[model samples]
Target chain A: MNDTDLNDLLHTAGRTDGTDSFDARADLARGRRALARIRRRRVAGGVLGLAVAGVIGTTAVREYAGDDTPTARQEQQSSSGVEAVRLVSQPLDAGSYRFGKVPDGWSVQGENAFRVTIAKDGDPDTHPDSFIGKLVIMLDSNAPAGDEVTHHNGREFWVNSDGGGDHTSISTLTRDGEPAGTILVQFPNDAGWAKLTMLEFLDSVEVLEGAQPSVG
Target chain B: MRATDRDAEFVEFVAEHRPVLMQAARLLTAGDHAQAEDLVQTTLTKLYVQWPKVRRSDNPVGYARRSLTHVFIDEGRRAFRSRERVVAEPPAPDARREEQVADDHELRASVLDALGGLPPRQRAAVVLRHWFDLDVDQTARILNCSTGTVKSQTAKALRHLRASLEPAVTLKEIP
Candidate 1:
């Protein structure tokens, strides 16, 4: 078609009638909620910055006091250890996929035969298609690539932090009979997902027969 | 601007421009009403989060439209990686009786189906250039590409549209 014809066609196709279902009120409410979420995140970030500054100050004071003894080192090591977040012992279903455990306060946002996305409760960005700040689980035939490999509970896990360091992907081979590909879980770094917890959660995913491998 | 003022302005902007944004989104999503609505919601929420920037922009509607395109492209990439697969055929068109003439609805369906078949960026190029009547430089700015790239993309999209819609609608050949 010529330019004018193409323009006319697009204009005709893009037209929306008065009967079009668009709720401006709901859009405003959602917008308000998103603004609230942004404010909360800012406050949380400020608090975290202050806490980090306090820890640094305290550590500097301790170092100035010649507290570098073996006993002090042991105490520091013990206190700085990451406390693994445990998943709740509950079964969750997302379409054809099933989860034996999930992090507390997290709920499934979207799912298909190929992938399932889980996000924190009360997350304002409820667009299932958006995976930012969420945990996504999928199966793919691509070989698992990671920075480190660790074995837990008879299953090997590959842990790779994304280039931005904002997210980590943990992948493990699916058990025989479920799917012949790797089951991968990518979790946001700020979501309180320790490597151990990620491994445990990935372990709990049961890829059903209907599950399809996600194409790259 | 003050918080209350910003909120009020944002609400007013949404009330005035949301329908226009929805129409653009409908074209971007190739006429999927539910998806178009979701895209609009996400775009509005993002705009709300950055209301100060929206207010500062010379054209808030243009800024929002740009944001909508970015969201659509982002979601399209994610969808490509996560769920896109080869479909053997497009969905069947509506059945028509021999006596019924193919109307605007049928033509609209044909156009949307063809638009949906184009890659997301190419489809976006077509929508921005044809539906929005944006010049090449403006389309390139929204797409964050060079003007030459916009021309080539629009050309390819037009060629595809010509081939796809010729049977359903009368059209002069595109040079």
Candidate 2:
């Protein structure tokens, strides 16, 4: 068959019954809800920015005021020496991959043999294949390329930031007796993940035999 | 744009263009109406979030089409991967001897089944190039790939379609 014939077939298959069942009003409602959600996120981000700025300003004022009292010094130490976030020892399963520990408030959303997506507890978008604002883990044959390398638990992990430094991807070689490829995890930079905690989580993953390497 | 004004324009746009968008999405999802609707809803929500940009574009409908296509290509990957199926079994020898003819519904099912079997990018190439009547460069722009890549993908898709549909469809040869 020629192009016209093929096009005809596609049109025929795509044709809907003439009932006009599409609900434009419903779409409008959904759109408004999404817009509200976007606005809320922007507001929350702005608030967080202000809080960080306030902390910096307070620190500078204290330094200029020569407030060297023990209590003030302890408060400054506490503020400057914020504890690094760590993963909890709770087991989580995503398809053939298993995580010995994950950061609090994250759970597996969906997974196939190729990749597993984990998202925060309150993420509105539930689509597993949509990776935005989620953590995606996959196994691939590509060599790990990143700006920094860190050795942890006898494995080397290559770390890189993408999406204009908003996202971070860390790749490391899978352990022996499992898939022979790089296992990579990608997460947003502001998702409250410290570099050491991310490394610990990556070290905890176990790639089973059913795992398959993703293709480009 | 003010909130109420933007919303009015968005509602109007959806009312006018949703049917065409749904048709395009049905083709993209290989006749899966449920998934097609989900794709349309997601696309419309995205367009609504960026309503100012949509209104500024010279062709709002075209912009919506491009967004629908991108959403299909991006988030529909896993769905398409799971939906892939083997080609239908060939007709029996006796039926072939008698020159089997299929009705419109049967032909459409066969075509959609074949289309569903293609890899995602190849299927997108066919839908954009043939179903949407887009030029190679236009398809490449929407697909975010080079024109040479578009030509190669479309060629591969056409080859697959011909091979799969030849036994199912017996159209007259064009001179």
C-alpha positional error of residue A71 in candidate 2 after TM-score superposition, expressed in Å: 25
Q: Residue A2 CA error for candidate 1 (Å)?
A: 10
Best by TM-score: 2
User: Against the true two-chain complex, what DockQ does each candidate achieve?
Assistant: 0.20, 0.22
For model 2, how does the per-residue alpha-carbon lDDT over A1-216 read when each residue is reduced to its tens digit? 223376778888777777558778899899899879867876997799687877655654564465677755554443326422346788878887999988667778879887888988889978776677788888965666564578998899988653334579898989889889889898766666656668888899999889987532
Q: Write the per-residue lDDT of candidate 1 for residues A15-123, one digit (tens) a residue.
A: 8767675566677688889778766876997799697776645544553364766754443332336222447779988966789987878888888886788888899
lDDT of 1 by residue, B98-163 (tens): 112155665666777778878889989988887778888678757755578888988888788877
Model 1 TM-score, 2 decimals: 0.54
- CA lDDT, candidate 2, residue B141: 59
TM-scores for the candidates: 0.54, 0.56
Q: What clash count goes with each model?
A: 0, 0
Of candidate 2 chain A, the 10-residue stretch with the lowest lDDT total is A77-86
Q: Model 2 - which docking category?
A: incorrect
> Looking at candidate 2, what is the lDDT of residue B153?
86
Q: Estimate the overall C-alpha local distance difference test score of candidate 1.
A: 0.73
